[model samples]
Target: MATIRERAGRWQAIIKRKGYPQQSKTFDIKKDAEKWARQEERAMDAGTWADQSAAMQTTLAEALVRYEKEVTSGKKGADTERVRITKWKRHKLAQKALGTLKASDFAGYRDARLKDGAAAATVRLELAIISNLFNVARKEWSFEGLANPIEAMRLPTSKNARNRLFLDGEEARLLQALAPAARGEDGRFGDGCANPLLRPLVQLALATAMRRGELLALRWENIRLADRVAHLTDTKNGHSRDVPLSSAAAEVLRALPRAIRGPVFPITPNAVKLGFVRAVERARKRYEAEGGKDERMLSDLHFHDLRHIAVTALAEKLPNIVELAAVSGHQDVRMLRRYYHPKAEDLARKLG
Candidate 1:
């Protein structure tokens, strides 16, 4: 049996049936309430009814908090996921009940984000977190009737692949800018960064093609200079691989005084990002002072581009795609191709 009543300007539909718990829902109109009650009663009669009270009551923000504690905390990119979760919590959509969220809501969100100048990749990642959360809720949080809104959405196609490479004299200028600031004999301070690790960090990044997180998380005990191998127990893809270090990379490690057993870089990711940005600013200023007019030189350089630069250089030396993939820690050959951007002249030389 079903009951319909007006409660505070809204019609409430209540259903009671044998072998089932009480079910209720509120609608703006009496017709809607009656329609909902009839549907639920029929579904219950057919033994197809599932409780959706949790989904109806829980907000996206609440789900995100639980997801962060249980799922995001265990991820290697937990810090990054935390940032994403924080962003999600700030949005107006996060206040909506989980059961009320539909594919249209996220389609509008995607369009709105793109209009607001958010990158396709950023929006995709944000949506991915929600999608996974929905799946987790359905499987473990007793929201089996809740359909994943994001699964029905057409995700934004990402076209953000960067081919930015270092120009001649740019690397030298960058290294000089990252150099340790030392007092001269005349008591004048030279242009350089206060952090001594910046130069070697850039050098090693150019040599190894490792991700920034991998480099920052690097430990002293993992480096075997004799074998020219750096064992990475933790990586982005959750797979461990021993990265083969080049002579240049080994020299950088040898130059630094080895710690007993701690972080090799001993720098936070935020610190590295700020230091790199400052270093680039300094380098650009230095280049301008040296009568260089090339605006493109050292412009729009990112820390992650160093990995691309290293992979591209390694491709010339290694020649074998599989060998390059192993060194670069790429699980997919297609993804490895994204990093390997050889000059047309270089490829022509190899062809001849």
Candidate 2:
């Protein structure tokens, strides 16, 4: 049953049904209110109104908040994702109802974000999280018929893959710069306390090709000192693999005093980023201070470039990609190739 009345110069429609909850709405005119009531009542009678009811109470911000608490909190990269979700919560789209989102809304967001100097990769990742939310809502939260708006939108093209490798003498310069910074006058890593970790950290990264996250996550229990293998319980690809440590890499680990039982290197990811950036700046400054020209100084180097150097070196020595994958944790041969950037001089030697 539905009833319409004029209340404060507006038509108010109150609908009641046997199996459904009571619905109420206000319209400028009685006819419009009556039309809405008729359509809703018909849809309810035919049992085709779940789409309207399922996501009516929940907004994208509310869903994402719940997701972060329930799902993203359990992830290894939870802090990073929590930050991204915080940004998402500030967007206008987040306030919209979960089922009310359209692809065109996101197209506008993508354009706006790009105009504001956000990278294509950053926007794509943001959209991916949104898509993940829709999938979770549909499959887990019972919001059926809700389509992922990302599927309707086209994503920005990703630029060329980074194949940055250490230039000649840059590796030595990085170590030289880090050597003094990792320690104080008393000689230590954290606030000049004890056991400076940067030199060993950089060396192990080159020798083992381990990611910054993997290195930071490493525990003493995971490292088999006798076998010289680091057991990774959680990798980026969601699979575990045993990484064999070279003698040099093993030496670095063996030298470090195990002060904490949880993580071998208890450092934040952002600390490593800031540390690397500072190291590069110091390295470049030192190089230019001497006879070295400004152009000759390593200004474009990144810490991850060490992984590329390690992979290419392994590719030169190792017989096959399978062997290289064991060291680098790359699941695909093509992805492994991206890291296997052999020096032109090394290739030129083969040509002769």
Best by lDDT: 1
Taking all chains together, each candidate's TM-score versus the true structure is: 0.86, 0.78
Task: Write candidate 2's Cα lDDT for 67-141 as tens digits.
Answer: 998889888887777878999999989999977789999999999999998879878988888888888888888
Candidate 1 displacement at residue 179 in angstroms: 3.6
Give the lowest summed-lDDT range of ten residues in model 1: 334-343
TM-score of 1: 0.86
Q: Candidate 1, 221: how far from true, in Å? A: 1.1
Backbone clashes in model 1, listed as residue pairs: none
User: Model 1: residues >4 Å from true position, as ranges?
Assistant: 180-195, 281-295, 337-352
Q: Total backbone clashes of model 1?
A: 0
lDDT of 1 by residue, 259-328 (tens): 9799999887777888999999999988898898999987989898898888989998887789999999
Write down the lDDT that model 2 would get.
0.82
